[model samples]
Target: MRFKSIVLVSHVTDLSGPSEAVENYLKTRSDRLGVIYHPFHYCADRRSRMQDYRGGTLLREARQGGWNLPALATYVKDALFTLFYFLRLGGRYDVYLGADPLNTVVGVVLKWLGLTNFVIFYTIDWMPERFSNKLLNAVYHWLDRFCVRHCDAAWNISPRIQDVRRSQGLPDAKNVLVPVGVDLEKIDLPDKSASEPRDLVLLGALAPSKGVDLVIDAFPRLKERFPQLRLHVIGKTPHDAVEDGVVYQPYEPRLAALGEGVILHGAKPHDEVLAMLPAYDVALALYKPSPNNLSQWADPSRVKDYLACGLPTIITPVPEIHKDIAALNAGIVVDYAVEPLADAIGRMLADPGQWRSMREAALAYMRSYSWSSILDRVFEESFRAKA
Candidate 1:
């Protein structure tokens, strides 16, 4: 039987990945689906917001910082607000998909209360130590395991998460791989013979674990070899010094030192990022090695976007997608180091024939990851009748 009515709950920091994909897909069924989003704004000037959508239309959207509290407090407040908002809507839905653990736990509670039929725990990122605080970290994992064992199904963004879960001996949650997908319809392939000094791009937040510093350190040597080569670093950096499993630092000065060789375009809209990917010859996803690095358990959406736009990527073996990319010859997988990353970029730029061939492979591989097809498979597997 097909699910007639659904609602998706997710925390929004940016317009990216699985959340955006799922929301867009559900909107097509606007007659029956709903969406609840809690957007967290880092800048004090930008207030937190809550958005509610139903029957394919936005029912309410509110923005205010009346309760401008600390990060932990904000999160707790958001969870309560989500519960109240669903209750306000009569609290009934056929399917409820929540992105992060906290959001999914809310759904599980609603299910326990007989307000929702099927609850999906959509695992986006899993780090060994999710929070720096010992008590909070323990609480986070307890909630995660609780959701997995209790939810109707656990939708892991990567297969590795399933493996990780089993290793932890968590009770069998009906696990499904709902990997990150690309918007194929919007992305046009870059011109194969576009002459260069070709450029490289790295998308998403410029975090320490994201390997932005490694990229910066390697840029000078790369620029010396190919005088006209440019590196486009997209997305924002930490607004303040904070610790949440990973340390945050200000890297604006370091980026500024590179001048014309490195172009920093901070946090563009997701659609704009898609539009800009095709112009670059190579994409970078060099995640640094750390036991707590979240990328290790993620199926990164940026890599998918790069492949969809027909740009061969230079990635570290941190994400689950890297294995497929390496196997398909769609991209180069290197250690999370400056030299390997720089060399990988050089190889892609110096050899026109190899880059073109890899670009073809990337496009071919990405066809399987279109949002429509991926979500269709997810629902089919999720809601399939058992005899």
Candidate 2:
């Protein structure tokens, strides 16, 4: 009783795992999948977008209300638009997978209205304090718990999220840990010798929480120890000091001030990031430690990308994926500090053999986390349970 058709009511934020999963399904079985995506813009220059896809083809793509829509207004609009869209389709989907609590609530309502057979609440990120506004934060949790209790199942990106859900007293709800996966098929790394100077790469938003600042701070000491080392950052920084409710100082100027050896290639396409990751020897995911940091509950896509590209990663303990990397001997897990980060990179630089071994382990570990395999397993088990 495999589910033949699926739909996702998701917010298109970045090229994260959920996006990759959608791509995987669309590529193979487009006729069996549909998506309603809303672009989460960080700047007013870009307008709000809504895209609809079915059978690997774009059904409709629209931009309206510019970027001035309030958060609550946006959610209401999304829900109403999705309800009408699903109604127009006559609700033939076997499964409805939503990317967040708001999106999942839409799916739950669809099920109540007899539009979809099963609803999957995909929990990508969860923080103790999700919203800065007290009222919004409370509402967010209420919606989150409501979705968890009402949806058929909850798909969490990390085990820690499942633990958090339990602590929130939703332990009885069906929970599945669907960790971030890598696209191994598109990876074509240059077959370079291990003796080549091992350069470092960090692939994510250039925000302080991503440990971009820590990497930059550690760069000088690391350079002093290993003169040939380079740090390649491949992502965009916020235009202002604040955007998307997260206040972060833009690192573009600081990165530019680093002169040479520190390359700041702002926001490359996802395919390009995959192509570029293999050129580096070590990956940095030094996420800052904070109780409110959502990365702590997420299986970061960047870490999976690094592993897939066969680059040994150096990450902090904030993400649960770090424990897996540390246990598998695929990467070093250091504290989120300048000195520890520098020391770890220095250690990796001094031992090329160990570095090579870790790289091999990384590649080996990523085989089990390929998109094709992960998606296949997820749908199979999910559909079986529904049957």
Candidate 2 deviant stretches above 4 angstroms: 1-4, 41-54, 84-92, 165-173, 243-247
For model 2, what is the C-alpha lDDT against the true structure? Answer: 0.76
Candidate 2 accuracy as TM-score:
0.90
Off by over 4 Å in 1: 1-3, 40-48, 64-68, 166-173, 194-197, 241-249, 385-387
By summed lDDT, which 10 consecutive residues of candidate 1 come out lowest? 41-50
CA-RMSD of model 1 = 2.6
Cα miss at 377, model 2 (Å)? 1.3
Local accuracy of candidate 1 as per-residue lDDT tens digits, 95-115: 888888889999998888888
Clashing pairs in 2: 30-55
The stretch of ten residues in a row with the least summed lDDT in candidate 2 is 43-52
In terms of TM-score, the best-performing candidate is 1
